[model samples]
Target chain A: MNDMVKLEKVVKVYGHGATEVQALRGVDLALEAGEFTVVMGPSGSGKTTLLNIIGSLDRPTRGRVLIDGEDTTRLSASSLSRLRLTRIGFVFQAYNLIPVLTAYENAEYVLMLQGRRPDERREKIMGLLRTVGLEGMENRFPRELSGGQQQRVAIARAIASEPELVLADEPTANLDSGTAASLLDLMAQLNEEKGATFLFSTHDPQVMRRARRTIVLHDGEIAADRHGPAGDE
Target chain B: MIVRLAWRSLWRYRRRTSITVSAIAVGTALAVFFVTMADGMYKKLIDEAVRMGAGYVTVEHPDYSRDLSIGLVVTGISSVIDEARRIPGVTGIKVLIQGQAVISTAGGSAGVGIFGIDPETERTVSPLADRIVDGRYLEGADERGVIVGASLAERLKLRPGKKLVLTTNDANGELVNEMLRVTGIFRMGMEEADGFLVQVPLDTARRIFGIGPDAATRVGLVLASPRDQSRVLEDLRRRLAGTEAAVLPWQAVMPDLAGFMAVDKGFNYVFQMIIMVIIGFTILNTILMSVLERTREFATLMAIGTSPLRLRLQVAVESLFLGATGTVLGLLLGGALSWYFQVHGIDFSGIYSDDTTIVGYAIDPLIKNHVTAGAFLLVGAFVLALTLVIGLYPSWRAARISLPDVLRSR
Candidate 1:
């Protein structure tokens, strides 16, 4: 499998001096393309930080991060922004869609930023919304939609551009169990049927069970990395 | 897309946007309205001052303005007036012998300023022509006819048909006197003019004062517009370069009035600036609040690969939109108000008596508005630029938002 993201000895420290807390302590991780992976840990275990670094949303304090074979550490801020624009996508736990834009517009934002033709953007966004079971709710604004529907739009946005990697940080944390399970299944189906890679950080066992590969983090360190059927663990 | 986003974002808080726009519009309208009214008042003052005293552009002996000497005279007054009349902007020309004299009757005597004017031309240029309250104005053939102010006539206990004697020195420094009949009485509502001024027929002064028929103390040129004063002055000076004539603008002739107008205009500009700055701060507060409330949304945009510059541009565009809308609306409302006032003046007679004057120039109590394109452009540009400048801080704050921190917190 092609390597989608690789990190070596990445460290993230918060605060300064006596108030310092190490969120990620010299941890190493790699994600291959088309891999349905989950980074599972309790609070403050650096799961979100790892996703941030892998998504190029945050720079590592002491280690190198590679996205699609390009060293993100050496890239300038603008260069990193361009890399993130064309190569990576993110889904936050809060379903961070621009409130002013409709669901379809929110989903089409990345493609628009990529300068795609409008018709192509319309086509892709329509198909993605349908695949995420939000086909008829394209015109609804974020405030007009429920939490599950908003998350669905966010997922469609994340994969709309066919990014090399999708980093979702507890995307289903705010949803009920049924909704969360449906979202996880949709993401898994996207991963398998469309050959899209997804890396998520969640404490939800549903996500871990749905994921093809699960890496367990404890206290800013990887305590275990496991693969195969989730039931085997 | 940026424009669409900015426009939508502005209307998201419709009440806030409306409030800010209203503040700017009202401030700008007040500035425009008051400025136009003040300008109209100034034009009236300058017009009355120049026409009642020296013309808009004057040609006199080089030292006459400084010394006010009867001996100082434009020797070739006829040619000076002729040449001035030929100038493109010179609409009317008059040759006058101006001097200090004393008027006396059996009851009293008072020091006065005498103006010898051609009655035919004075009718077109002087406000006094329209202000005769008694009898008739002087005629070119009535060399013995004189016009006395209402206050002066009262002090001298005279009537329209009364006789008075004007005593002054001739050009040769010999005592000369003339018997003058009060053909008219004029009330200018200004004490200085109404109490101390007398006008006589040009021939009578020339014959009595021993001035040559073709020579006079000053040659005054009336212009079609005040803006033509300088050009006509310059052209007159250039045409009469070798003569002892000094062509001067009315501002130079009446420094006190000029100085008053200058200081008044300065204060007006400062007041306008204060109004604009206050409006600018209102815009700043509204935009800053919008930015603060959308911290997480801005962070999301940044995370979605919008450049910091783009985010700043969006904010700046919002400010521009707000400023443009307000300025346009202000111009329309202010223009309408000014046009109405221009046609129907604001009556200030209750606040000010007809005797009110500024720098010895009589003031009209009914004030109108005068709108100039320059004034409109200046106020509009100032407001728009001020809003843009104030937008900088909020746009900077928008661009500088820390994505990771905001996302983590929100």
Candidate 2:
């Protein structure tokens, strides 16, 4: 499999001098294409920071980050933004959809950034919304939808542009067990059927059990990495 | 889509948007109203000044304005008056012989300006004939008869038919004294004119001043419309080019009033600038607060690959929506109010003890506002530009938001 993301000796420090806190300490990792992986860790264990560096949402303080074999750590901010726009998609813990836009518009936003033709964007967005089981609720805003529905719209948005990678930071943290299971099923179905790579961060045992590969982190370092048949997948 | 997003975002906080819009609307309306009212008042003042013997055009000896000497009288008064009458906009022309003199009675003595006018012709150029409050106006048959202002009459304790002595130098530098009977007492509602002016017949004045029968100090021309002052003056100047007389428009004769009008316009603009500054700050505060509240939302957009420039443009678009709505509403409201006041003037008589005059020009107590298309264009452009400038700060702040920090905070 082609490697999609590589982090080399990444280190992240917050604040300065004696008050500084080290969030990531010389972390090295890589994700292959079409992999359904979860980075598991307790609080303050650098799972979110590692995800941020991989997604190009941030730059590591003292290491190189590569996305699809391009060195993203040396790129300018604008170049990095373009890299994020064309190559990666993100889903936040809070299900960050633009409140003013409807679900359909929120899903179409990345395609709009890509300057896709209207008819093609419409076809792809409609298909994705249906794939995520949000076909009839396309016109509702985020506030009008439940947590599960909002996360589903966010997933549709993440895959609308057919990005190379999707980084979800605690995608199901706020949902009930039934909704979380359904969301995970949809994500796994997309990965198996379309070969879309997803790297998620979570501390939940149920979420870890649903991933095909699991990497455990403790005290800002990776403690274990393993791959197996995900339960019920 | 960006515009749609911005528009929807603005209405999300309905009460805050309404407050800002209302502030802009009220500020703009007041600016429009005050500017229109001031313009109308200035127009009225100019018209009144033209009617009070400073007719639209005046023909005088070249040196008479500076010296005021009886010896500097124009010799060919009849020809000058005839030429002035032929001008297209000229409605009337009158010969005037003005000199400084002293009037005395049993009660007191006071210095005054004596105006020699032809009663029949002067009636067409001045409202003095209509303002005779106590006695009959001067007629061609009444020789040695003078019209005094009510204030002057009161000071001299003289009534109609009472005689007073007028003393001034004739053409030969000798003091010439004449006995003049008061034929009328006029109250012009202007302290300068009422306190120190007395009028007599032209023939009587010429005889007392020892000049030729056709000689006069000045000739004043009235126009069919005050707006034609410059055109008529130009025509008169071309006609009287070779003579020793100089033609002057009323603005030249009343420089102080002209300068005062210019200063008044400056003050009006200062007032408008002050109002715009206050409204601009209000807009700035409102937009800044809105941007601050949406910090996390902005960070989300950035994370989702929205460029900082596009985010800033969205904020600017929101401000444009607010500004456009407020300005349009303000113009409509101000235009309607001005129209009502134009048709039915605002009466200020209750605010003053009596009719007030500014710089010897009497004005009616009722004032009207004139709403021109220019005023609407000016106020609209000003408000829109101000709102745009005020939008810049908030937009820049939005563009500079630290995405990671904001997302982490949320």
Candidate 3:
């Protein structure tokens, strides 16, 4: 499989002088297309920093990131935004659906930004909503939905454009264990059905257990990389 | 989708948006109403000044304007009048011989400004003909008959048919005297006009002053509309290029009135600009707060693949929507108020006396509104443009928000 995301000796530092803190240190990673991977770490281990650098939402202080064979570190901010729009999708821990938009609109937002036709956006969003078990709840706003349902809508939004790389930062952090399990089941089903790659950062053990490949981050560096029994590469 | 998002986001803070919109609406309404009313009042003052003395456009000896000398008179008067009458905007014309003269009754004598006018033509243009409080207006055949202001006749202790002697110099600088009967009395509502002005028949003045029938000090051209003054002045100047006639507009003849209106209009515009700035600040505060409170949401949008430029565009669109809505509402309200006042004027009789004058032209106590379509559109466009300008800082701030910091904090 082709590599969907590649990070080469990445380092990210916040502030300077006495206030300086390193978020990531010389981390090298590759995520292949169609893989369900999780990067597990405690808070301050730079899980979100890695996700951000890989998503093109933030630039690394050192080294380079490649998404879909394009050098993101060399791209301008506008160009990086275009790369993210076309090649990447993100699911946040808080299920950051636009509150003013309905569930269907939230799912359709990326497609609209891609300048797709209305008919195509509607078809894709409706199918994704059904697949995520949010079919009847399409017209409801994020505030009206429960946390599990909002997270389902967020998952639908992430994969709506069929992006090559999907990044989820602690997707199940805010959900109960049962809801988290079902959400992981939904993500796995989508990964298998749609062949879309996903990289997750989480402290949830269930996510780590379900992950086909798990990379453990400790103190701003990778401690170990493992493949669980469920699916191994 | 951007517009939809902008519109929905505006309603997210319904109370704030409503308050901002209301402030803009009220400011715009007051601006429109006061601007139209002032336009009407100034129009009334200009018309009163021009029609009563020099017409909207005047023709006289080029040197007569500086000296006001009876010796410097416009010759070939019939041809000048005929040529002026052919001009497009020239609605009427009047020939007059104007000079200062001493009028003596049996009891006393006083100096006054005397005008020798074609009584027939003056009836159509001058309000003096219609303001005869007592007695009748002069006739073309009454060569010795004259119209005197009520205040002048009262001061002289005279009545209609009473004889008085006018003493002045003829065109040759020779002292001359003519006896005139008071044919009419007029109350012009201005102290300057009612106390110091007198009009006599044109032939009688020519005979008394020893001037030829073709000689006159001034020929005034009345126009159908005030806007036609400049074009008519230009045409008359071109037509009478070599006649040594100074074709002047009313503003040239009435500098005090012109200056007063200029200062008055300047103050009005400054006042209106202050109102717009206040409205602009209200819009700025609301939009700035909205952007500030939604920092996390904007960062989320950027992280999810929406460009910073697009986020800024959405915020601008929101401001534009707010401005357009308020401007439209204000125009409706202002138009209704203006229309009502245009038809039924606002009475200022309680506020101002009837004889209140701006540079000696009486102001009518009732003021109407006169808003042209162009003026209305200009005000609306100005407000909309100002709103857009005031929105720029907040949009820039929105685009400059740090995505990583905001998302990490959330």
Candidate 4:
């Protein structure tokens, strides 16, 4: 399989002098295209930092990050933004949908950023919303929806632009157990049917059990990388 | 879509948005009221000053205003008056013989200005004929009577029919004196006129000042519309070319009133600036608070691939909506207030004396506001521009927030 993202000796340092923190310490990893992977770690183990560096949301202190074969470390801030817009999608732990926009607008945001035609944007966004089980709730704002529903809208937004990689950082952290299981099922279905690559960070055993590959992180370093059955199906 | 987003964002904090809009509206309304009142007050002052003695246009010898000497009289006065009366906007022309003199009665003596006017023609040029409070105005054939201002009469302890002696140097440089009976006492609410000016018949003044029948110090032309002064002056200047007289509009004749107008305009601008600054700060505070409160949301937008520039533009659009909404409301409220004042007027007699004068010209205590399209345009532009300028700081702050830091906080 072709590589979708590559990271070599990536180190991220926070603060300065005596208050410094080594969030990522010389971590090296690669994610293959079409892989349903999970990064599992305890709190402050640099799972989110690593995802940020790979997604071009943060600069590494010392390392090289490549996405779709282009070195993102050498890109300007504007170019990094362009890279994120065209090649990557992000789903945050809090399901950060814009509060003012309705479910349909939130889901269609990335497509709008891509400047797709209005009819195409509406069709693709509606299809994704339906796939994520939000078919009849298109006009409801984020405030009017449940935690599970908002997360589904966020997921639809992430895949609407057809990015090469989708990074979900504890997307189900705020949902109840049953909603979390349902959301995971929908994401897994999208991965299998559309050949979409998804890398999620979680410490939940339920999530790790469902992923085809699992990488464990300890103290800002990767401890083990293993493969298992794609268990949800 | 961006516009829709921006508009929707404003209503998210409904109370805050309404408060900001109200602040701008109140500020703009106050500005409109003050600007209109000041404009109307100044116009009233000018009208009163012109109607007091200085007609819309004045004709005099080149040095008459500065010297006021009887020797500086305009020759061939009847011809100049005839020419002036022919000008289209010129409604009436009257000859005036003005000179400084000393007036004495049994009780007092004071230096005063003497105006020699043709009562019949002066009636058409000035309101002095209608302002006689006691006794009768001068008549064309009555050459022995004079009208003294009320203050002058009180100071001299004289009444109508009392004899007063006036002394002045005539055109031949000889001191001439005349005993004249006071026919009327007039009060025009002006200190200069009520205290020190006396008007006599034109023939009586000619005899006392030793000037010829067709000679006078100046000619005052009255116009139907004061706005037509310039055109009539231009016509008079052309017609009276080669004569010994010079023609001047009232603004040239009364520099103090003209200068007051300029100063009043400057005061209006300064007042407007102060109001705008206050409203600008309110807008700045509101928008900055909004940015601070939505830091995480902004970061999420940036992570989702919105450029910093576009985010700033969205904030700017929000500010524009607030400014436009407030300006329209303020204009409506202010227009209603101005229209009410124009009809009923604001009575200042309770706050100030009824005889209050500004820069030597009497003004009515009751004032009505005058609104102009330019005032509305200026106030609207100022508020809109101020809101937009104030929006930039919050927009910049939003653009500069680090997405990673914000998300990590969440």
Q: State TM-scores per candidate.
A: 0.92, 0.82, 0.93, 0.85
Give lDDT: candidate 4, residue B369.
86
All candidates: CA RMSD (Å): 2.8, 4.6, 2.6, 4.1
Q: Is candidate 2 or 3 superior in TM-score?
A: 3
lDDT of 3 by residue, B1-410 (tens): 99999999999889999999899889888888988899889988888778888899988888887899888888998898888888888888988889889999995888999888888888988888999998899999998898888888999987788999999988888898989999889988898999899999888888867779988988888889898998999998998998878899988888889899999999999999999999999999999999999888888888778898999999999999999989999988888898899999999999999888888888989998887786689789999999999999999898788777888875
Q: Flag the better candidate by lDDT, 2 or 3.
A: 3
* Candidates by TM-score, descending order: 3, 1, 4, 2
For candidate 3, the per-residue lDDT at B202 reads 89
Cand. 3 Cα-lDDT = 0.88
The whole-model lDDT of each prediction reads: 0.87, 0.85, 0.88, 0.86
| Candidate number that wins on lDDT, 1 or 4 | 1
State the lDDT of candidate 1 residue by residue for B1-410, as single tens digits: 88888998999999999999898899888889989999899998888778877789888888988999888888877788778778887777878888889888997999999999999989988899999999888898887999999999998998899999989988788988888889999999999999999999888888777888878888888788888877888888899999888888888888999999999999988888888888988999999999999999898888878877888999999999999899988987888898899999999999999889887888999999988887799889988999899999999999677677888885
lDDT of 2 by residue, B1-410 (tens): 78988899899999999999998998888888888788778866776676556477888888877887889988888898888878888887878888889988987989998888889877766788889998889998788899999899998998899999988998898998899888889988887888898889988888888878777887878788767888888888898899888899877777778888888899999999999999999899989999999988888887878888888999999999989988888888888888888889888899854548766667777888877888899999999999998999999998777666677674
Scanning candidate 2 chain A in windows of ten residues, the lowest lDDT window is A224-233
Error of 1 at B95 (Å): 3.2
The segments of candidate 4 whose C-alpha lies over 4 angstroms from its true place after superposition are A1-3, A32-35, A174-197, A204-213, A225-233, B53-97, B104-108, B116-130, B136-146, B158-166, B170-183, B200-252, B258-274
DockQ-better candidate, 2 vs 3: 3
On a 0 to 1 TM-score scale, where does candidate 3 land against the true structure? Answer: 0.93
Alpha carbon deviation, residue A91, candidate 1 (Å): 1.1
True interface contacts reproduced by each model, as a fraction? 0.51, 0.47, 0.55, 0.58
